[model samples]
Target: MAMSNAGNDYPLSEVPPEARKGLASLAMVLLGFTFFTATMFAGGKLGVAFGFADLLLVIALGNLLLGLYAAALGHIACRSGLNSVLMGRFAFGERGSKLCDLILGFTQIGWYAWGTATAAVVLGKYFGLEQGAVLALMAVFGLGFCATAYIGYRGLEILSWIAVPAMALLLILSMSVTTAKAGGLAGLLAIQPSSSLDLSTAITLVFGTFVSGATQATNWTRFARSTRVAVLASLIGFFIGNGLMVLIGAYGAIVYQQPDVVEVLMLQGFATAALAMLLLNIWSTQDNTIYNFAVAGCNLVRTDRRKTVTLAGALIGTALAVLGMYDLLVPYLVLLGTVIPPIGGVIVADFWLRHRGRYPLLAEARLPHYNWPGLAAYGLGTIAAFGSPWVAPLVGIGVAALAYGVFNGLTRGRTTAPASL
Candidate 1:
């Protein structure tokens, strides 16, 4: 099949050396992508459940693990110039890759629908709009959010450059207000937990909240100019950016008993800033989310019409938002945390163990219809993760990697000469 690289984003092909991006462009976009409101909501739960110091520790440890996982994948992405879906062709085979496309694509669309609903509902309540107006707003924002994604990576980068700084300033302002209200560090430390939650659950919530996004972040990291840039950007985004969201949410919950950042801003008498924060925060992630859907859509259909797919996804997400995707956030997040990490694990194992840290060019390589080892490993990993009481995302990744390694080893041994064996 002939591949088109018209937009230069190369959805179905390798991102060539000349098209690689610098640290600032990649990092800013990733930061914007990670600055999600749902993550803040998850953090709010942790804030009320644990003591201040314990909450901090949970946030640090969870984000640390997420950062390391993303950096490892980003390193491979930068070297190979392929995102997770494209890499899926090698890990899961040409036809088998559709499993990842379907899974990852569905998750991204789910997020897009959630974000769209969130923006409309929050704005409607803030402005005292009726239900009809709120639904209309959902339709409007749903289409508007995908504008950047339709233009591809350059559009995402430009918006991120604008949104990341503004969002950062807003977060700092909200945190400062919360700090003053709590009477500074001493008072905040003295605040008792309002509820009880186990350490394991807290860590799981923190890590699981954004694991899916981290898994697909290779969509951007593949454009990194070097492996160093990719790894650093991934850490900065997943660790620092995601950590700030968790910290701010917990801080607000502890002080004002409100976990929503917009509400916190309103309580601090920054109503205008609250509206701005809501728009910027959701828009940044919404675009990235839909972009992910489009990329997965392209791979699923074997097309290069990413812009068209993006528009179609926007329509679907908008419809879902209108049909009440907002109410499904918690369960949806739980599902994401459970199912998404194993895909990354399989890709990592395929690249390092089977392909020896290098993948053949997708355009030229002849791929099989299915790779049983990867499929079987993913199944084992998913089952282990679902049944495990520990951090599900981490368990999924580890099990998937180990299973793939064992399967590959056995296959290699079976294929070896009898005399050599």
Candidate 2:
């Protein structure tokens, strides 16, 4: 977490080759990204909407798709040794990349607030506490959540060491208990969906839970030793780790009519277990979320004041959670799910197609002030994404890629100094 060395500049000009890691270490870090409680909540929504078979199909294929997308970016990151916001510098321009930093970073704040609010409100609920007390609890939890992010990636890796395995065991326990309550998987398959949600919407929600995070896959994957390591790590983290979260959430919803894994655990008379689950599950994600905000903020402001920026970000996100502004951000988060993937699309195009899968050094990569082609592609992609409901995020990605290829084919735009300076 001590990102004080020139070799590891704040926001990372490039991860030194000597610092690169193999599949195991990178996988561990990427795994932290998938260990998100919101994924479980999204799974619960799908559980209520579709039958057992349908739900399994949605979760598997939906996340597999996202995993592949993230892996693609991971490959790019490992090859270039660049994080997402820095990649935006190539595709979106030095100044235009700030938009990438803002959109990607602020979304993390929204997630931070939402995760904090959920944890606090539920913790308060079990105590039969009032809304005012719940708000106070949000502040307390928010501070605790910000601690790791303040330390950066090292903090995330350390927290994941204890939290990931413990959280997985609890989820498995909850599944076992719930499966028994449903008289086993056969009976669970027989349970009818309480409501109908279209397959497209369910899949969208599945990806939406982590698509923004998916775009940011480069953040951790830059640590990978090779493209193979990056790709495999991302696939395992998002596919297996993320898939399990959805399955657990779906299982809880189908058997107990509860959308929350922690709530279901509590209802099963594992109140203490639920508390542990709440702390580990939400805390693992909250710290990472705030850490992400710090990185993005540092990129946006072009500063090395990551700790100061982290504190400011935590204060802003905590205030939003306590004031209930996170509720207002939820719909926006959904819209962001549709809008943000285009950034990835353009980056993929610029990295693979335009550059032929190679890039100049980040410190010396002369780029345009504004890559209008990339921005235009993203704009068109976002519009096209909302025009239909069938796989909105994927649609955005495809449109952005195609449009970027077309626009980037034009004469080279004016080049400028790299933002890393």
Tens-digit lDDT track for model 1 on 1-421?
3334748378898888878999999999999999988788888998888888888899999999999999999999998899999999888889999999998999888888888998999889888999999999999999999999999898999999999999898888778878888898888889999899897888888888899999999999999999999999999999999999999888878988888888888888999988988899999999999999999999999988898999999999999999996577548656866888999999999888887787777766767788889899999999999999988889999999999999988887221111200
**Candidate 1, residue 408: lDDT:** 87
Count clashing pairs, candidate 1: 0
lDDT of 2 at 104: 89
**Which one is best on lDDT?**
1
Model 2 off-target regions past 4 Å?
1-3, 6-9, 130-132, 412-421
C-alpha-based local distance difference test score of model 2? 0.83
For model 1, the run of ten residues with the poorest summed lDDT: 412-421
**If scored against the real structure, what TM-score would every candidate get?**
0.96, 0.94
lDDT of 2 by residue, 290-356 (tens): 8788878888988767777788888888899988998899889877887889999999998876677
> In model 1, what lDDT does residue 333 have?
56
